[model samples]
Target: MALTQGIPNNIYGLHSAEEQFREKACSIIDADTGLQLHLAVTEAAMDMADVLRQFDTSDEDLKVAQILGMRTFNAFGASIKLTLSGYHQNSALILRDVMETVFLLDLFAGDRLLIERWRFADKKARMRDFSPVKVREALDARDGFTSKKRFEVYELFSELAGHPNMKSSWMMRPQRDGDAVIGPFMEATALEAVISEMGRLAVQVGEKLDHFFPANWDQCLPSRLAFTQLKLKWIKTFYAPAGGP
Candidate 1:
């Protein structure tokens, strides 16, 4: 199988050697299987979600859940409809797991079915040509019209903390200025808020998984969800745990 070289300038611009190496490694693996790895990993994640939805999650369910948990933590594609600017550096990693999990659930029917099978093997075409406009139109054309809910937050932390301005606008308050500590203090406070919310979300997620998967809920839920966090690229963005720099 021939692999494409030379990174495009439009998107994925100027990745580091390490990033390129990892992407290439992933590319090579996917090339042989015709991106079936993505589909399989995606399917596995859905199975895991299903297992979570079930009352009696078996050993096989737990195994699949763990694997899916890991995969969901590492597969995502994000686009900015607002602007080309303000793309988070490691945002891809952060949403990888959740996006794959959701995508598999919605796009595929518990099977590795494609919502658009043509996208997988269109050698002469490019995914970039699949415009956002077209996608929006398709969604609009769907029979089930109103009361659709958007997947706003990837995790509980995002729901609580809300999206922050990465470029913090420093306010010049002479009263608060005490040895270049204002920026640090604000950033720290923001971080603290994230951690607090994430902790709460963790508890909620644990309870939900327990409700869904009773058999392996106790045995695998912690490890599975923990793996989800581990594969996440930027934990700091969501809110680093307490005592973090």
Candidate 2:
């Protein structure tokens, strides 16, 4: 239950807005309230990492999937740290990367040949050849899971978070009254939703792999499922419109 255990207390120290703003910073936001949300996200990622570690990485498909899973875990951690430090914009961008990694994890889980080709292709060629839209479509067709709406939401959030447009820029801009603003604000509800999606996508990828390698998956399922249930409970309690009471 101690989610911060083993995680450095100072992971976000270097980026703290209070440290940077010194006296000029506006009132520091209390990130502690969302600690549980961060913990849930971290725990889910660590669970995935634990499951992947138990598998033999000698197989090319497993190796690539592990690599992608690890990357997703790292990004999940980074996004949480950034959000804690009041760098919500940066966190959003990282979440975008996490979204893509989730899609690729699913793709590579289903088809090893595609991953092999992607790995061997020239970097530039690979960049040109890679298409997330196509990949999602293929995954949807193959698995019968509709992800178009999910992808649309991901793209919208990514654009808002990554671009320098007026919408997102307001988060960090100062008011005409000389008040400093630190933003790209992430509400607890929004954070819960994002982390919930991340956890769900991870579990989905694991499920896909299970269909391919049932024996290898049996040992990991209990822990993964437990953590997933815990995450879902949290989401429903705090984020669900009718369930928060």
Candidate 3:
């Protein structure tokens, strides 16, 4: 068999069954023109990471916000990696984790006292007041938001991956009659949905960071620029709907 570079070419007996899968998968995904939007979204995440890193850590609040931003970025990166490897269900679970972090980060950014509470909250205290449901309730009740269910995305992802629900299982056994599929198999539609979901939530993350660093918002210029450029390129290449910046 021709060797796929950067992936183990030599394999003994059982290991031969798992040769070069990730390298080959990435090659196929990279070559697919139809996935430019997904590619653009991935690029946007990377660029945002760079932007998040540049924020000045002048105070404890800024430091916490920066840490939360970094954590969210890393979680998002993990989800992308899993999706690329055809582990959509696991990726969605990571996305669910990220959704909660983003919501809490938003609340903490808006309320300095919350950040202080979070920094030293005991396990029981955290579960009592800072659970996912509580965070959503607190954020939605905060001033300046639409007050409607602004964080139902967390629940949606929970159903899709976090909970032991039928929909979550469908990621593995997509076709009811089909066997439960395991690990690293190509599923274009599922991959697309995962990537699209990551891309959408990533935008929300950017917004949260932007709000967190309002005075330093100009520091995010590169991130916003990268997102805008990617969107324009996607529209130009794929004839996607245009949206103003």
Candidate 4:
């Protein structure tokens, strides 16, 4: 008798494993909670776009806002798509980029010097000093806001998800099942956390806008009201303890 007689010679096991992975991915990606989060982010981007359209592109603040809004929106959309496709780690990386954009926007909103520096950067050359940490620190110092904790948390999460270190590799470790090894499944919680953080940041940016440009709110009352209502609905549906059905 041959010693290797017990092994199956067909590719059925591989096919079965692939099917299991697909089913697992679908369950998390198609869940109601995830869908709600995605919708909330989408609505935020739409409202931001509407608000941006009200400002002339030639205005310095509007120019900065446009760049920040476009970059944040693109990163957020990419993150959502990556999460839905079972690329959770890369999604987190994109979410980290979203957070950076938010911090940059906040800094620009508070500091005239930074805004001028950004606006006057060489048109043909890329900005080489747009560090998120530095921007956050400057903004916090200028505004007396304590955002160090949140920035640290975002940095740690991004490193774990985006780096090529052991921590990132270990997250996808396969499970041993006799002679077979099953790969790691998608992590829905990570994507949920990203969405929640992004939502919070968006609300903060909106509040800042209202505080800094009260006249804009009055001028654009109808649009502002619509945006505020959308934000409130999102909070009630996904964040409030007694709200979601």
- RMSD per prediction, one decimal? 15.6, 8.6, 6.1, 8.3
Q: Model 3 segments beyond 4 Å from truth?
A: 1-35, 56-58, 143-152, 174-177, 214-220, 228-245
Q: Tens-digit lDDT track for model 2 on 1-245?
A: 45665656565654454344422212222343344544554566556665776676567756767777667667777865665445656767787786677777677766778888888879676666556676667777787876577568666765657787766663353332333354434344444444445555554444443333336457777766765676666566556896445
TM-score of each: 0.28, 0.65, 0.74, 0.66
Error of 3 at 236 (Å): 12
Q: Runs in model 4 with CA error above 4 Å?
A: 1-38, 50-54, 121-130, 143-147, 170-187, 205-223, 233-245
lDDT to native, each model: 0.34, 0.60, 0.70, 0.60
Instruction: Residues 1-245, candidate 3: write the lDDT tens digits.
Output: 66576746343522443334446556766777656565565567556655767766677766777788788878887887777666788888998877787788778768878887887889999988998888888887776567455566776788878898777777886455677775555456677678767766666676576666455467677777777676656556655457834
Residue by residue across 1-245, what tens digits does model 4's lDDT show?
45565557545665565466547656764676645654564556546645665665566766667666767667767766565545556667776776776777777666646677777667433235456666666766776777577567666766667677756654343322223223434455554555566566666555444333335356556656665776777677667787536
Give residue 78's lDDT in candidate 4 (0 to 100).
78
Worst 10 residues of 3 by lDDT: 9-18
Q: Give the Cα-based TM-score of candidate 1 against the true structure.
A: 0.28
At residue 176, give the lDDT of candidate 2.
25
How much is the lDDT of residue 65 in candidate 2? 72
Which candidate number maximizes TM-score?
Answer: 3
User: For model 1, how does the per-residue alpha-carbon lDDT over 1-245 read when each residue is reduced to its tens digit?
Assistant: 55578766534543343354345444443454423323333333333444454434444434444444344423322211000122222222234234334333322222222334423536434243223233223343453544332333333323322233322121111123433222111122222232232333333233223323444346546544643543242234334688877
